[model samples]
Target: VYADNDPIVLVHAQTLLNSSAEGRTAYIRADVNEPDTILRSPGLIETLDLTKPVALSLNALMHFVTDAQDAHGIVRRLMGALPSGSALALSHCTPDFDPQTWQKVTDIYHRAGTPVRFRDKAAVADFFTGLDLIEPGIVVGHRWRPSAEDGGAAGEDGGAAGEDGGAAGEDGPAPSDADVSLWVGVGIKP
Candidate 1:
């Protein structure tokens, strides 16, 4: 299932998914804040079995939702609608590592009218309340379950930037706190 508030994005995603498979894919032009729209979408109902476990992934999407929008509440509501065994996989931007730098980035996003709220580890973890956190709980986006081909500095292969990875340029080595500015995790609803 694919959904987006932008009609164009929904159409585009639908086109791509429809081409790959028929009748197995559905795209809904809806907003995440409105849990009912997504949960009650006829297209989604036809494609996904609501009674079964569903894996909901929200990657780099929550930051776009500000406090005024009650981002956390919206997430909780969405998850509450799913089955007990449903899973939530998410990655959120955080300013815990380098507040100064992340603040600048947040300011830039605000200037562009797309305000981003960089939450700390604790704040991000709050979204997973009542759910059983998977292995590696909430950690830097790159540090969560790193793989051999991982592109971040935490990767066993020395990362994509060739050892001197991360935003600190060579001053601070890879796998540093400041380098990983996003928290990632997966949780299952009890």
Candidate 2:
């Protein structure tokens, strides 16, 4: 469920569908605020199986939601509807490190008509209150168990292993175990 109010994305989706004769794809023109409308849509309902475990991905979207809307509440509502064993994959921008740069980026979004509300590590963790975190726990995007070939430490830097060879402290401790612009984690409903 890719919810974006971008006309260009919709246009591209349409083109992809038209070009792919063997595969099946459909695009819904709506906003994330109206989740019920999306769930009731004929195509969405038919394509997704609510009874099975589904991966709810909210990458780079939560920051757009404000306090009044309760971004965490929105996530809980969607998770409640999914069956046990469902997984949630999320990545969100935070202000823990490089507050100045974060603010600049946020201001840019605001000027573009899509204002962003950044959260800290704790606030971001609240969104996954009821789910069980996967191994290595919640960490930055890159530190979440990278491939051995990547040649980087696992988990956020600066704790113990990071003392030897890791990114400098100017960026504040790599957030979790990776070097990413935001926090990322995967959780499973049990």
Best-performing candidate as measured by TM-score? 1
Cα lDDT for residue 105, model 2? 84
Q: Quantify how close model 1 is to the true structure by its C-alpha RMSD in Å.
A: 4.6
- Steric overlap count per candidate: 0, 5
Instruction: State the TM-score for model 1.
Output: 0.83
What are the per-residue Cα lDDT tens digits for candidate 2 across 1-190?
A: 4545689998887766542455445577777666666667776676667898988888888898887777887888778888999998988988776788788888898899986788888888898899998866666565566543444444344122453333334446433432355778889999
Cα lDDT of candidate 2 equals 0.72
Q: Cα deviation in Å at residue 175, candidate 2?
A: 12
Alpha carbon deviation, residue 170, candidate 1 (Å): 16
Q: What range of 10 consecutive residues in model 1 has the weakest lDDT sum?
A: 158-167
Worst 10 residues of 2 by lDDT: 158-167
lDDT of 1 at 119: 91
